[model samples]
Target: MDALPTDPEPTDTRPTDAAPTDAVLDRAAGAVIGSAAGDALGAGYEFGPPLPDDARVGMVGGGTFAWAPGEWTDDTSMAVAVLRALAAGEPLDDDRTLDGVVDAWCGWAVDAKDVGNQTRAVLGGLAPRTAAAARRSARAFHDTYRRSGGNGSLMRTGPVALAYLGDGREGDLARAARAVSDLTHAEDDAGDACVLWSLAVRHAIRTGVADVRVGLPWLPATRRDPWAARIADAEVSRPRDFDRNGWVVEALQAAWSAITHGTTLVDVLERAVRGGRDTDTVAAIAGALVGARDGASAVPAAWRDVLHGWPGLDAAALTDLAARAVRR
Candidate 1:
């Protein structure tokens, strides 16, 4: 591979003490762009008609597409919410994080568009208290909802990983991922897998893409569990041929394996989409992780422009937020 050219020195007149490392900035940019592009591309096929393989390249959701070209679904919307909340420097406790998540949902709901059924149900039952009874009630409600195990939690978990990186807190990122996921998905397998994947993405961004060890620790626990183990074993044996029928376990494993095994952002996403179930959500998860690892430059340029119509925050804004989060 050719060496990347150095970025031109900043010419701004403002006095700045320092700038972020190129790798960090690149990761942030990749994460934001990759996520939006995936969301937009995936949105076109969201529980809808399929596209032929030849036309899949550079596809966006315009008139030819159903939901408007470049429009993101619940996946990116929820991710933006998490990123925004964490950018405000909130701590990662269940109560506080759940409140932030609910607040985000309410904000999106008030827009009166693009809300998912499962997410709406979970948010509708949320109460604004941290009392023991409230906690127990919330947990039970969330657990019941977890049975759905939709890819919703995994789709939105990227920001949590980016936000908590380098905080010197082992498993903190994973825990935060779980807290946000528990807002709508509290199943142990689903929630734990979401956290593990999020942490893996963060580790990939901070380290290089070669460190599969970043994901190994979390796998042991996942492997010990029957549901998670089945997914893991399947991914190890046949990553490219995994199933994806909104089964949380398979979806999680498929996304993780795609990132770990594939050589490029497109390869990972293609693997994810080909898994055949809940294709959009699976692609979204794989996209976010690969985006963080490879940086923005690695994503195809044409797809970035196609993601312009997505609901929720803009890609550049999210990148700026990630950069700011890193600086803080």
Candidate 2:
């Protein structure tokens, strides 16, 4: 464990047409970098049990896959695919752009250190490799096996929020989140979690407040009440209680539970990593939310200095890419 600030406060500002202030830029960049940081931190503990409260946690690496220290796993790699697509002026709303994302994913998956089971099955067998085709494969995989409610989609969802920020289009944000998630996770639960998380990240980027409930209205009516209750439960429960941390619903619950109980960015991420199974994914999810609220400057300097992953990105490179994404 590391030092955590006490209740870091969020800036009170919204996205504007003018060049973003440093605080906004930091938060935007933080959302991506913080995610990678947590992913790398938890990578070493991928399938392990919860650590004792006082146990040390760092970017040790070498888990289910022997990831290098401070090297992010599939979680950040996939998010980078999305970020690269957006940074290149590709809007995820367009089929062409989504297909570009899938192509990036397939290209990366070939050499990636690890790939989620649900995502691998869909991407490996994709015929056309088109976004539409990927969706079809995802649905088929889900239908035949009834196993698409995994956390793969949610783990890479944070950056989708960056695409529509300051555009004043919450509707587009929700749509893009759902569509992007559907490419691999055709389940309704998967899409719903993405919508909620994307909007939640957008809200944090804009107003500096972290509230997953912000996207509840964007979900179908029947889901609203149930998700609301889930979110409420997360706030009051402990992260370890949601033992099935691989499922989308429980994943969100575990992450939110950690975020709700922790005060600073480091604290939230620590709580998430200590939640046991699927450590990296849960920590990555919580990291994005906390980073949006706290900004990049709030991340521990030690962690940021060493943070890195696929596509040859280190901390500053990731920050510049996020800047491009926000400015674009």
Top candidate on lDDT is 2
Question: Per-model C-alpha lDDT, please?
Answer: 0.61, 0.87
Residue-wise lDDT of candidate 1 within 1-53, one digit each (tens)? 11212222221222222455788668766766676666666665555433343
Local error of candidate 2 at residue 121 (angstroms): 0.5
* Best model number under TM-score: 2
Those runs of model 1 whose alpha carbons end farther than 4 Å from true positions after fitting are 1-20, 48-55, 62-65, 110-113, 125-138, 142-148, 210-213, 216-240, 309-312
Candidate 1: minimum summed lDDT over ten consecutive residues — where?
1-10
Native RMSD of candidate 2 (Å): 6.5
My TM-score estimates for the predictions, one after another, are 0.78, 0.94
Which ranges in model 2 have alpha carbons more than 4 Å from their true place?
A: 1-15
lDDT of 2 by residue, 220-294 (tens): 777789999999999999778888999999999999998999999998888889888999999999988889889
